[model samples]
Target: MPDDRVEVEEEPVSETRLSLTADCGSCFGLCCVALPFTASADFAINKEAGKPCRNLREDFGCGIHTQLRQKGFNGCTVYDCFGAGQHLSQGTFGGTDWRREPKSAQQMFEVFPVMRQLHELLWYLNEALTLAPAKPVHADLRELLARTEALTGGSAEELARLDVPGHRQQVNLLLLRTSELVRAQVPGKKRNRRGADLIGAKLRKAELRGADLRGAYLIAADLTGADLRDADLIGADLRDAQLAGADLTGAFFLTQPQVNAAKGDPSTRLPGRLTRPAHW
Candidate 1:
C-alpha cells in the first residue's frame, strides 16, 4: 500500500530569489493562456494549445492555486515559469492585462511561451555553469548565459519572432561540454553500458546514487526499491522505467515534467513537486 500519510513539501517561493532568475509572480498568468495542454499523461483535460485554462481567473491568477491536486490538476503544481511569464506579461508589456487589451492578447500570448523557453534555458545553463568540474568551460558558459539573458529581455515583438530552437541548440552544445568535463573527472572506466538497452533490467533495491548514467536508455528497467538519491539523471531516458518503491530523493536536475512523462506505480518515490506517475 502507498504511504498516503507522507506529506510532500511545497517548494519554497523564496528559493527563486536566491539566484538572478526569472520571477513568475512579477508577470501575469501568461503560461496559462500561452501554452496548451491536452488530456495526455501530464494533463487531465484536453486543453487546446493557446487557450486559457478554465481555472484561470479574469485577474490572471489560477483559480485552483491552492487545491490543484485535489481538483485533479496536479500538473500545474510542478511547473515553474522561471518568471518569464510574468516578465513578459507585466514588465515588457507595461502591466497591460491581456484580458483588457483584447487586440494585443494574441501577441502577448504568443510571446509568453517564447520567453518561457528562453528563461527555461537560462535556468539550465546557469545550473550547468555552477558545477566546479565545469571550470574549463567557464568562459563559454559566461558568454552563453549573457546571450540567453539578453534574449529574454527583448521586446514582446522581438521575443515572438525569436528563433528559440536555435538558441536551445546553442545551449545544448554548452551542456554537452559541461557533461564531458564532469564525467572526465570520474575515476573509472567509462561505462560501456551507456545508452545501452536496459529494458527490464532487474535493478530492484540497487544503489545507483551519484552515478553517471547520462543518456542511458533505461526504458522499462525494473528499478523498484532502488536508492537513486542525489543521482545525476540528466538526459537519462526513463520512459517506462519501473519506479515502484524506488527512492529518487534529491535527484539533481530531475525536471518534474520529465518525471511525470514516465510510468511509475503508487509505490514509486519521487521528488517533492511531482505526484506518483498517473499511469501507475
Candidate 2:
C-alpha cells in the first residue's frame, strides 16, 4: 500500500514531546514498500513487500498524493505509520536513505513492521497518559511509556528481533484500566459490545454514549446521529459503517482506517489528531 503524508494541527501533537505521528519527508517510502496488500474494496491492486508502488516518485512521494481515493486506492489514505518511517530512516539506521544505500533496504523493510507496532503502542500509551481519570494508573502508564519509547530507539537488529506482541499485551492491560477509569465517569452501566457482529444493524440516532464497542464488526451499520462520544472503538471493523452526523467526540483509540472506511459528512464530529476524510 502507498502512504499518505501526516496531517498537522497546532494541537494535534507536539513534535518535542515524542513524534508519535508520521513525518513523511524524513522517511524513505517504507510504508509503501515494507507492507503487502491484495486487491480489495479499499485497494486497487496487489502489492508485495519490498517492492515500490508504480506510483512512487523518485523522491519517494506518492505520485497520486491528492487523488488516492478517486484512483481506487482509499487504503493509502487510511494508513498511518505512527512515525515509524522516520525512526527507521533516521534513528535506527543513522539517517540512511535506503535508495542511496541499497544494501540497507532489506533490513529496513524487515524492521518497519516491528517499528510500526511499537509506535502504535506509543500512540495508545500517550493517549492513556492524557486521561485525567486514569490517574490511578498514571505511574504505570509512565513506566510503560518510557519502556516503549526506549524500544523505539533501539538498533535495526534489535527492533527486528523485538517481541512486539508481548509488549503490546502488557500495554493493553494498562489501557484497559485507563478505559475503565474514564468510562466510570459516565452516568450509566457500560454495554458489553465487544466482538459483536452488528453488520448493517440499524443504529441511527441510537443512544450509545460511553459504549464499549471494542472489536465490534459493525460493517455497514447505520450509526447516523448516534451518540458515540467516549466510545471505545479499538480494533472495531467499521468498514462502510454509516456514521453521518454521528458524534465521535472523545472516542478512544479510533484509527484513520476506521474513519476512512465509514460513511460520514462535514457535520460529523471527530476527536483531536484526526482529520476529516475528503471522500466524506
Highest-lDDT candidate: 2
lDDT of 2: 0.83
TM-score (all chains, Cα) for each model: 0.72, 0.92
Model 1 lDDT per residue over 179-240, tens place = 66654554444443446667778888887754556667787788889877545666677766
Q: Evaluate all candidate structures by whole-model CA lDDT and list the values in order.
A: 0.67, 0.83
Model 2 misplaced stretches (Cα beyond 4 Å): 1-16
lDDT of model number 1? 0.67
- Give candidate 1's TM-score: 0.72
Worst 10 residues of 2 by lDDT: 1-10
